[model samples]
Target: MSQNERFDNNDSDSLILSFNGDANHEFQEINENLGIVRDVIRNLVPLGAIKVAEGIVIEPVVDYVFESCKRNPNMVFVTLYYARGLQEIDHHEGDSVGPALRDMRKKRIECSELLARELVHKFNDQDLLFTKVLTKRYAFSQYDEISNRKNALDLATRLYSEMGNCGAIFLSDNEVQACVYALWSGHLVPRISRTFPILAVIDYYIPNHNLNFLENFKNLELLNIPRNQYLLDVFSYIMFLIIYTMVAANYNEIRELNGFLEGSMYLLVFSFILNDIRTLQKHGIKEFLYFRRILSLILHVILATDFALRIKHVTSFDHSIPQFHRKALSLVPIFLYWRVLLTLEAFQPIGRWLTQISRILKKSMSYYILLALAFIAFFQSFLVLENTHKRHEGDDDHLGDKNEWGIFALLVKGILNAPDFPGASKLENRFGFVLYSVYVFTVSVILFAVLLPLFMTAFATRRSVPEEYLAHFAHIVIRKVKHNQPTRYNYPSPFNLLYFTLVLPISSLSIIIGHNHIRLYANIEKFLTRIIFFIPMIGFALIETHFVNDKQDKEARDLDLRELPGLPFPEDEKQMLRRILYGLNDIKEQHRSLHFRLEAIESQLA
Candidate 1:
């Protein structure tokens, strides 16, 4: 056989073994070797073991196993095992040297295995391939030990240069998982999910389709119990509504309800401000820029101003100025409207519809502007003609005055085609009647004719906005409101204000300082700090477990049964199976082509 034929046969044999051979046996062998390595390391002291392993048994055996695994790219389990063993040894030594060396070795193994797999699998999925490459680059930039920081710096520099030429990788599900795991392991810095492309994609694609009203009701019921900052806000808003309703119904008995309403309003404003501050802290200034948030903030200011005005009026200090009270009363409707708008966000469908309407209006803005200008010009022309004709046919008969059209009345009459419209039988002059007819046609009929099509086109071309973007906002709000935190800190307005302002800041600072100088603190102090933080976390977790009910997992399982590429299919093996079918199709096509060529050759020979 030719050399190429032999090579092709060997490739086919390897492909067969990869799919049908017992992966379990290879896994068991790798596990056994890992056990031996661990046992040998456990027998020696940290210092002596490092020196002896360098000169004798440990280094050579690990190198040999790693090198042999190179021939079989599918044996990544072996590399993973070796890395785990080395990490254990590094932990045992309580020194940076072992981990530094291990990290370097792991980097090499990861790169080699990744490249080999890419060549062997030859996956058609660009997304998957890009993610693998990104993960490899990220892994190289992260070292397992502080001593290897310089190596990390060098890797980062090289990776940055390569990235510039290759372009940024599109984040797939696998890349998201890798990046998240790396972050959890302290290889990557803590960042907002929006900072990472994969995480952002996940946030955008994962639909929050399920809404548990029972859970929401339970949360609402427990609003006053003081569980967290979010609940406090809800509680305050509810109380404000109740008080405002009572005050509105009992305005005549204002003196009696003043104290209660004022107090509730104060609490409401404080809670709103606190929530806004928390949002600012979490998402930075961008949160305040959102339309809903901006409107809410404006309402807060208006309400606070109103409250101050009411106080002044009650104290008899500003009794002379009834205008202040009127101003405050005028703002009440606006505040109520703002609150109603906020509630729209809780129901996604309504919010989506509103979003679509807003989009259509934005697209049709120019048409509306043109219509407005036409109306203005026509109204002005009619007003000028009415004044001129009235003066021309002076008040001698007093007939012009009786038939006169006021500016406001003329504009309304003209638009609505009322009986008093100038071109209607009311106008006597031929020129004036012709002018009025032209104005009505231009402003009403023609302008609307142009506008109707634009409106129709705008509505017809409306696209379904991705629910993911909308869901992300809702998720943030939901997370905040349903956040599990210590009950003690979730006090009502005044107390919450104190806790958040004073206690929370001090506690946060101490935690940060304690973490940095952990050894300086005694075990008891460390344990106490951990318990304090863990209490809120555990409570939140339990609440989520009972209420959230693993919706994400359920969605993933449903997707899998439907053969959809859901979140859990990041490591899917189905793609590999498809490769075999693709190969068969290619072979069939090649055979048919060769047969056609053979037929042509035989006919020519004949």
Candidate 2:
């Protein structure tokens, strides 16, 4: 690619990974470098071997002899020449040689493969050959340190030379290199999955800022994203839908998995949405909203297609091996549905949108269409079963026969896929309007109820809670009150409508008690269902009411405390003291009563 077309390293940064095309040339150069490396290694090995042996054994022997003969004049000369040569090589070759080799590579100096093999052998040997070179070069009585460092440097240079990049290895020392194998050997699958989105975002969308939607995609690059984050999100919506549909199918397995899957997926969805909001904070709100909307649209399309296929696959005319799955395989689509729903819910607006009917007629239309499809499937199944029994001439022989239902399916399928004809076209026209009306009504209701409320709540909170107010609120609720716990919902403000929704049950307890009664339940199923449905609602309501009420009274309580304490004393204001003391006593009594009631209710609930 041309320079302009090449990946941008700024603004719209691109990961432009290019490989060296001149592989033969690069290999030849590396081999040549290795030849020179071998010559250096061959010289160094003997020196290293001698030094290691000397450092281990000879040093002590020399010291013992020297200390016993300290007055001897010859010992001084023996030490002098040894010290000088050691210092010379330590300064010249040991310190500067590695850098000089690197510089030679930069200068494109060619070496031979023979030299590479020689160096590799010497370093690998780690015997007297390696130690002697170090002892001769350093002239140090102790050659262990010199031999170790030289061998390490050789191995490092060889690896880097072969790799071409050597970026990571060259920066660290030999000890670091040994520890790095653990990281290198680890599975890259998870990392690859996580990075895939980032690469896709940059490749497909980053360049077209006018398509500016790509800014939203940048949030995926967060390093601390939860494990199997994408898969978890997918699981959330899928599990939810699976349980929902399987409940209709009367599958016991569905119910069992539902609770575990639902709870985890819910948390996953919340985390996903929370992350989205966190991401939005980096970008402007408008862009954030746009990015979220686009993502939602994409998710919705995928979910819709999945659901459509599931219906078609399950309600097929003939069982030429179930297209989707043979057994609990249908649960896959169900799980997928749950994942999509939960993920969408992670973005509060999207979740709410799925539940709500934008227009009254739209939901009615969906119900009608659903009813029609169900009727057709049911009738088709019935006919196929009947026909199969008739062909077998005995219901007893064809227990699995379902051919009677095929006729109905064939009819329905024919009409659905019918070609436009003079008479058939007229029939289609009559039904088409009704179908369109239903679609419009359903879509409108969904938008109005589900999508609108969610967006409104989110936007309202964002607008109402200015940063200054948020800071002040945080100071009061978080710092001063020491209620450092985050709310169930990470609302922009405490004054959000969501708080109202949470508190609704607590505020209006009579509404729940009036219609719902445990006394009439005939089975645990109904009782558990009712309780499960209301538990979170009731619990959240209690929390919201308790907090919100306390929040409201806090200011007045502070004002009273601040002003009451400063009032004139009994000597100057007898009447004031009487009123203030009596009031304080009354307040203490009231507080005690409230605390008693709270404790009693908690005990009962428990």
Candidate 3:
């Protein structure tokens, strides 16, 4: 691979990351200069048992680490280091240390086996080691355009292999103040399950996170996500999908949606509310009880309450429901569909694009503020030109409006590229027509032509740093991979309802009465979860053991037709799997051919 062919760092002035004060970006960047980082680690670490990586030759580092271990087997000698690769010393400038590191960063397999064992696997939850490991993960983020999901798995594999619990991060025990674990897991693990059977690889399961991980995959075949996160999002997506299907199935007859479909949907809603309540309990009452959070909470309650009592609203209206009720129910699915797009962050390519779009939108906030000021200025100008006189009979304040469209709506439509000049011509306010003309010119000329380009330029700048987003993505996977928080929050949906109503309440009552009457909560919770979610839970349980025992299966693919096992799969599923492999191979060949053509063209042109 050449320098030009390496991953785009988005060199167009968009700073790579610079995430947050907590992210410690400068510390990560310093590690890129290998020599300085190694010396820093060496000074802090004891010599007899130090594992080092930095400016030194990549080959000797592992050997040196092995030698150090032999010298002191009991002690862990971890010294971070940097050096130019010795073997590349005689190579041309194009194949020097920089390019070599870039290549290694992409392939993420060859030199990485030793590096993964040395750096990431042995990592403890110290602040310094945490930063070092995170930076190395970022290096692992560099790959070709198609991407390699297996790259970050190497980091995740080592991480999960070594650590089984999430201890205090940076010596901070406070939950609110310390969101280190939340930050780590939320970014990476859920995403990695896309390609690998991340479910089977981990030794233990974190109940709540596992539930979330399974929720993302959709297919019941691969059920390995840990459970820990409550209803982190405001609306429950799976519930929404189920309810939306029910609503669609019984469209126009809202009263008919009241039977089993309604009951199932309500059950899901109740479970979601229960999860949200538990999440709320973790916070001080002041957090959401105050005016800011209180407002959203109040709105949430009203919406849920309205939907809950919806049966009463529909049952009274003969064969149909009120228009507003029907509209409200339908409007919700639109947002849920949008939520699915947000969840696509678990996929690398989609996640990167979404990240860029978010950055661009965020950067455009100043532009929005500017636009707000413009709107206010023009509206005030229109007010100054207001009149009591009517342009014609029946001409009201919204004479410029088309049907249900208000004056503001009409103006917005025009700005959005669908001008309503005929409607604006009917304005009854004094000088309203004149002001509308000026408004159109100002918005079209000054805003569209001028401000729009500035925003586009900012978009390009934000789009540059693909690596930062990848780091964020890998962090999400690594977080889940490392710690298996054996908390009792692993139940999913309706099953979660069982745990909350019976198991959780029973556990709480035991604590309150000092009776200890409840059976082991974790055991009971697991038993109930298995019974309720037997299809996914049992499937995961049976398959995961083989993966846990066989380390090679992590990267193994059964591509050999002759060696393929026939495991009594249905004929249809086998055919579907074959088609999937065929499609994948076809795409791979296209990419390979295009790459070759590009290389040939470049050689001839040069």
Worst window of 10 by summed lDDT in candidate 1: 164-173
Candidate 3 lDDT tens digits, 1-606: 667545455543345454443246433343333333344333433234323323232535544543443422111212211211211222334544455444432222222233433433232243333332332233212231212222223333232222211011111112111123323323122322223322222221222323333443333323224322222222255555667587566776645556777677666667756655754664345434323244335434544755845756655754344555665665555455555555456554766776576556655667676677777786555443333333434455454333333556767865786766665665544356676777777777656644676567565656353543443444444433333222323554555677766777767766786645435654665465555555554445443433222221211211121134554334466347545755786899999999999999999999
lDDT for every model? 0.45, 0.33, 0.43
lDDT of 2 by residue, 23-81 (tens): 34434443343343334323433322322321232323333333443322222222222
List the candidate numbers ranked by TM-score, top first. 3, 1, 2
The lowest-lDDT stretch of 10 consecutive residues in candidate 2 is: 200-209
TM-score of each: 0.42, 0.17, 0.50
- Model 2's alpha-carbon lDDT is 0.33
Single out the weakest 10-residue window by summed lDDT for candidate 3: 164-173
lDDT-wise, the better of 1 and 3 is 1
Clash counts per candidate, in order, are 0, 67, 35
Scored by lDDT, the top model is: 1
Query: Predictions ranked by lDDT, top down?
Result: 1, 3, 2
